[model samples]
Target chain A: MIAEKLVQTYKVSFDQNNQELALAGSMRPQRAAEMADCVKLLETSLASIRGTFYVNVKRLVRLNNVAFHSLAGALLKAAEERPDIKITIITSSVIGWSTKKFGTLTAKNPKIVVEEYDSEFYPGQAFLEEGGFVPVLRTQTKLTWKHERAILPRHGLEPGMTMADICCGIGDFAVLVAKEFSPSRIVALDHSKSSLAYARQVASEFDIGGIEYIYGDAAEMLLEDGQFDFVSCRHALQIFNKPEMIVNELVRICKPGGRVYVTNEKISQCLGEPRGPSIEWTYEQLSKLFADFDMDLEFGPKSYQALQRAGLEDLRIESFMVTNRDGDAQAFADMIMAWEEMFAGGMSEKRGDDAAFVEKFRRGFEDHIAAALHPGGYAGWPVWVASGRKPR
Target chain B: MDLGAGQTEAGEFTLLLEFDMDMAGFTSNWSYCDRLSTYFARMISHNRSDSLLYSNLFSSALNELLETVYRLHAPTGSFVCSVSRNGAKDRIALTIPVDTETEGFYRDAVVVLNGGDVSPRYHNALFSDGPLQPNIGLLELAVDYAACFSIEPADGNAIRLIAELTLEASAP
Candidate 1:
């Protein structure tokens, strides 16, 4: 069965002050076909907005032939509905596929225009995973003894060594490695420029040196081979689009005999699992849901095997548990909410009805929190800490 | 409607607040940013029902603008934020200037916002420029929370952002 349109797949807004109506997201056929509905919804929300309506297709990675027609037709309807409105479609140079249609779509209506923009990274993969984590949350996790042991000496990190922290969200691990091991050189690389800047700020507070920050994709880093003595990425493997490729890339950049550490959650180990209502969902569930629907999730647990496949020796996996006491029910709720918010978009494919599914998950998660708050109750989950050595 | 900072008139359809600061003041102090967001959130929650849409929009718009400012903050640039209402519409405007070196980065962001390209691809590409951070504020300010918004370039090296909320039924 064809899935329903993904909720929040695209967002439309009309800024009256600026006289602009903006649309952003991948214009899939389902969403594009509902253009009139979108127009109706916006009009219902705020009828006063009328002027330049811009649809930025730079991030709209793929538009089916039908989607192009649907979107163009919708905008024409919008323009006709309100003769005062001009429709503009902004596209990226990388999206050569949709530009020609946009040009033809708007050629007849002077009210519509196509603008092309050049961006270093548009319509690209997520560079900053987990939405650039909170510094406090990151530091709290890092300050743990077990985390330190897994990442530090156990991973063979030491002074005078060169290292790379791949997908280094906010570079907290890089800052820690730089501070504790005093590496000769450390490269903090992530797709998020803001996280890197924060990482730089954190690193600056310490007397660290030889730390360079690079903003680029993990799958395709511009670093030289054998450049670092060790490489590490934490809490980001499962969410990566291509875990094996990233693992191979990590292996490629590490000096022979250097160590590589990758950490991620085994969905089955997350707190509130096995106890919450059957409605409780994990990110892994979303992936499976999409798979069942014949769609690609491109996210899941892939650390240990990928490392071994990269030919790293002495591969090992250590599991650590994070638990919350009855007193920490609120904290538990926050955690569940964060996870739901992050992965909800993926669940859209499997949603029977957007609101009901969302409400079910939300209410069920809340009930689980209430259960956790019961006398002597506790919630915990396991984290897979894995490492291997690059062959010389 | 006298839409000035800190102006509150009883029985009026709207209230207005304005703020102006430099990059150093806005980014150098986290408390300041937090206070600004909290104020916007509190004002709407206090003055109206807990369901006021503009309240959340203001919070999201301010946070988004602040994140961008941190990424492209100039040593001596300015930051301007305004929250006003014209009849049934509540509006917010944020403007910040970037350092010359980072102007290209800020410009690209403006392009994405103006184009209404908020896909992960566009955002990831825009943010890939390590220097980008997560816009949790903007994420929280999803389209469900606001009527409309836009991003564009302003005078000099600054970027101007605006978010609007229409309160026809909810107007007092």
Candidate 2:
């Protein structure tokens, strides 16, 4: 009878894509017969199964109102029968229709939950320029021991050595490195006092000691010259208004024979974007802003040029391709959110709420990443760690 | 068996599936495509009389060719599958839009089809020597499925791969 119903209406069948059950094909006419038939098929298939079921309807292009109801009913019935089963339906946040429809459908069923993901959904609150640091526009930090182990060894930080982390926005990298590298004292400075307070709280929570969190201008720190055995800045160089002045401070604070490491990621180099309406324009504005700061756009392996220009020796520059296996799209989405905040007038003037801007760039990122990682996708970005020793 | 004057047309018929190639992702999960081709072959072969041994071999051959295509390409472009009929013969074509470099590489392959092997010689100003690595998928179709296939350049950085399968008429 269900097969007969499918014959009368549109064809729908289930296929397995890894852990998820993918239901593909079109559903039209919005008739109850077709809806009932689909429900019956789902019930039969799910009655014997237990535990969580991840059903993805992304491939199903069209579904009538009644079909949504039928799907909801079938999912609810399955959940009620098992009592332990959890049903999660992943959908696009941009589609208002699906949001409302799925919302209404899952309203009564406690077991059924609809999860919406959009690359542009900035999780953190957007804060306008405060000490040249904005928390809302920040991407997830690479602060793990793996990233630390990559850059810290070159510095040869002894246990009693002092280090300075200038422009330490949230102090994540500095804290992680301080704990792992066993430095005697590490002073982390940032322009944003609020960010410094938060970073201090995080450091205290981690019980990391022998560190001081200071709120000050990096380019004009009062610290004595050659006081720090090692000086490093991670990822926040491009945001500085005068990177050259700050680099001078980084060099000034470092002792002779001590190491100065300036590492940054070239976002554009790693995250390829497919040409879309707003992609070129958004990046163009960001580039202009970066130019104003004298920040090198190509800041990875080529970063040594800046340090070399500052008169550092034994310069070693290594560029790595850091693949985003777990959260590639989300990280890129956050990057767009940051750009949107940084250029609010330019971005919002074109599209209010940054949804359109986010969607265009986010989709471009997804598509580019998909194509790059296709046939099988290892999504990644380029990270350059350039370290040079001060003249001995 | 009464074979009436069959209809022969030149124009195209219906299009089947259109898929985008994600080469990196597919390199690891290639079995999915293999399974898909076999499933599609079974679906298309339904309700057809398989009195001749070649019919079963033909379906298997088509599945093999589809799987081979899945393994070779990076799957970054659009893959279009369309079908057209000429009298008793049905031709299924899979067209993929590829970059110029890839198209050049494809042009130099040594292909074996219909139990006969042929190496297509190409004369290019850039590289006087012809390319290598035969289009093995096409060769399998010709050998096992008794199908005639060809790989030729299409519009705007794309190549067309077409295979013709002739079906025997049933008893009247």
Model 1 lDDT per residue over A13-43, tens place: 6556665555654343322335666556555
Interface RMSD of 2: 29.9
Poorest lDDT segment (10 consecutive residues) of candidate 1 chain B: B45-54
TM-scores for all candidates: the values are 0.44, 0.40
After TM-score superposition, the amount by which residue A182's alpha carbon in candidate 1 deviates from its true location, in angstroms, is 2.7
lDDT to native, each model: 0.56, 0.54
> What 10-residue stretch in candidate 1 chain A is worst by lDDT?
A1-10
Restricted to chain B, the TM-score per model reads 0.62, 0.58
True lDDT of residue A122, candidate 2: 22
Residue A172 local lDDT, model 2: 76
- Tell me the tens digit of each residue's lDDT in model 1 across B1-172: 1124566652343447767777676777543443465365435532331122233334434545455455556677678877677755666667777666666655554454445535444223222322224342343233323346566677877867666665333211
Off by over 4 Å in 1: A1-151, A204-210, A273-301, A325-333, A344-353, A371-375, B1-172
Q: Write the per-residue lDDT of candidate 2 for residues B1-172, one digit (tens) a residue.
A: 1111223343644333233344444345534333434334333432232211122333344544454455445346555554455545666665665666556544543243433543221101111222212353454345323577678766655787777776433200
In the range A1-392, model 2's lDDT, one tens digit per residue, is 01222221245554433234555443432234656666776776565456666666543433433355457656766777787777777653222224434554365576777775432222221233343444442354642235557556765655667888887777776777776677776777765545666776776787776566654456656444697888988765655545677788899999998988877766556443333333444444445445544444555555688788889999888776655444355454454445544544433343343567555544544454453445444445567888888998
